[model samples]
Target: MALKGSFERYGAVAVASHWLSAALILALIPLGFLMQDATGETRLIFYRIHVLVGVVAGMLTLFRLLWWAAFDHRPAPLAASRAQHMIARITHVGLYAVLIALVVSGVAMTAKSNLGAGLVSGDVALISPSPIRVPPRLAHGVAARLLLALLVLHLAGALYHHWMKRDETLSRMLPRTR
Candidate 1:
C-alpha cells in the first residue's frame, strides 16, 4: 500500500497513524477511570501506563498532523452541501483540538504531581505522596469525557455515510487497493 495519501483515499501511513492514535486514546480512557478508584501498587502501575500512553499519543498526534498537512490531498466533498462540508471540517478540527488538549493537560498534571522522575526511576514508592487536585488534572478528566462523546459522534457519522448513504466515505480511510 502507498505510504502517502491521495485525493481519493488515505494511504498506509495515514491509516496506521490514525488507528494507532485511536487505539491508544481508547485504552487510556479506561485506564484513567480505573486509576481513579485504584490504590497502592495497582494505582501506581495504572498511573505509569496512563502517562506513558499519553506521551506516545501526543507524539503520534503531532506527527499525524504534520504528515497530513504535508502529504494529504483533499478529496472531493462527500457532503451534499457547503453546510455539511463545514460541519465535517469543524468536527474533524474539534477532535484534533480536544486530543491535543488532553495530551497537554495530562503532561501538566504529571508535572504538578512531580511524578516524572520517580516514574522513570522505577520507584513506585514515589508514585504519589497523596492525590492532590490540580486544575490541569481536572481539565484532563473533562477532556477525556468530551473525547468519548466526540468519538461516538465520529463513529456514528462514518456509519451514516456507509450504511445510510452508502458512499465511499468510510472506505476512504480504510486500507484498500487503488
Candidate 2:
C-alpha cells in the first residue's frame, strides 16, 4: 500500500479515508434521526454524542479533501462511454460538495444556536428545537438528503462498474489484499 495513488488504483490513505468517512456518515444519518425524537436526559446524551461524532467526521472530510487536492491524485477513470464518465464525474463532484455543505451548515448551526455551550452545560433548553426552521438547520437537513441521494448514485455507479462492466472501477478503491 503506497501513500499516494497510482494510475491503476487509490493509495492506502485515500482508501482509508473513503471507508472511514463512509462509516461516519452512515452512523450520522441514523443518529441525526434518533436525536430528533429523543427527550430529557437521553436527548442530551444523543446531542453530545452527535456533536462529537459530527465534528470528527467534518474534520476528517475536510482533511480528506485537502489531501486529495494537495497530496494525491486519483487513478484514471476506467474505460467507459463518455456519458458514463460524465455521470461519474458529476456524482463525485456532487458527493464532495454535499459533504462540504453538510459540514459547514452543521458547524454554523452549532455556533449560532450555542449548541456546544448547551451541551456542555447540560442545558437542553438552550438548544434550539429542530422545527424552528433556521437557515443553518434547514441547510443541514437539505444537505443530508442530498448526500443520501448522491451516495445512492455513487453506489449504483460502482455496482454498475463492478458487475455490469466487469471493470476495476470499484476495485480501485478496495483495500489491497496480499
Candidate 3:
C-alpha cells in the first residue's frame, strides 16, 4: 500500500501514526491527572513518562503533517456532502492545530514549573527554571482543555460517519478487509 493512502484504506504510515498517537494520548491523560497528586520522586517519574510520550506524539504529529502536505491523501470519502467536506477539512485542520498547541503549551507549562519537575532532560532548557509562571501555565492549561473539547467533537463526528452514514471513516484507518 502507498504510504499516504490507497484508494480506500489508510496507508501504513497514517495507520501507524494514528494508532501510536491514540495510545500515547491515552497514557498522557491519566498521567496528567495523576501528576496533580503525586509528589517527590514519583511525580518526577510520571512527569518523565508523560513528557516522553508527549514528545513522541509531537514529533509524529509534525511528520504526519509534512507527509500530508507533501503527499496528500483522500481517504475514500464518506458522503461527499458539502457539510461533510467542510467538516473533514475543518476538523482535520483543528486536529493539527490542537496537537501543535498542546505540545507548545505543555512545554510552556513545564518551564513555568516551580518544583523540581524535570520532564525534559537536555543541556539546554526550553523554558528554564523560574517561578511558577502562572500566565503560561494558565494559558497552556486553557489550550489543552480546548484541545480536549475538539478531540471529543472529532470523535463524535467519526462515529456519526460510521453509524449513521455507514462510510469508510474508520475503515480508512483500519487494516483492509477486502
Candidate 4:
C-alpha cells in the first residue's frame, strides 16, 4: 500500500494510525476502569502501566493529527444524503476532539495530584488518598463517556455504509492485502 493516501482510499500510514489508536483507546478504557478499584501493589502497577500507555496513545494521536494536516489528504466522501454526510463529519471531529480532551485532562489530573510523582518514584504513599473533586478528573470522566458515545456512532455509521449503502466507506480505511 502507498504510504500516502490516494484520492480513493487511505494509505498505509492512515490505516496503521487508525488501528493503533483504536487499540490504544480500547486498552485505556479497560485499564482506566481496572485501576480505579484496584488496591495495594496491583493498583500501583496498574496506574503505572495505564499512564505509560496513555502517554504513548496521546503522542500517537498527536502524530496522526500532524500527519494528516501536513502530509496526507483524505479520500473524497462517498455519495450520501446531506444529513448522513454532516453526521459523518460531526462524528469524525467529535472523535478527535474527545480523544484530545481525554489525553489532556488525564495528564492534568496526574500532574495536579500525587499520581505523577508516585509514578516517578514508585512511592505508594504518594498515591494514596487520591485527590477529590478535581476539575481535570471530572473532565477526564466526561470525556471518556463522550469518546465511547462517539465511537459507537462512528461504528454504526461504518456498518450502515458497508451493509446498507454498500459503499467503500469502511473499506477505504482498511489496509490493502495485495
lDDT, model 2, position 111: 78
Q: Which of the two candidates, 2 or 3, achieves a greater TM-score against the reference?
A: 2
Clashing pairs in model 1, backbone N/Cα/C closer than 3 A? none
What stretches of model 3 exceed 4 Å from their correct place? 112-131
| Candidate 2 clashes between residue pairs 3 or more apart in a chain or in different chains | none
TM-score of each: 0.90, 0.93, 0.82, 0.95
Instruction: Give all candidate RMSDs, comma-separated.
Output: 2.0, 1.6, 4.1, 1.2
Residues 1-178 of candidate 3: C-alpha lDDT, one tens digit per residue: 5666866677988888888877887787778767667765566676677777888989989988887778767566655689878977887788788788878877776666643234444222322333236666676567667767777888898888789888778878875555
- What lDDT is obtained when candidate 1 is compared to the true structure? 0.81
TM-score of 2: 0.93
Alpha-carbon local distance difference test for all models: 0.81, 0.85, 0.72, 0.88
**Model 4, residue 142: displacement in angstroms?**
0.4
lDDT of 1 by residue, 1-178 (tens): 7887777777888889888988998999899898878776787888889988988998999998898788675566675667767767778888899989998988887788656766677676666554537788778878888888889888888888899999999998887865
Residue-level error in angstroms, candidate 2, position 88: 1.1
Say which prediction, candidate 1 or candidate 3, comes out ahead on TM-score: 1
Best TM-score goes to which candidate?
Answer: 4
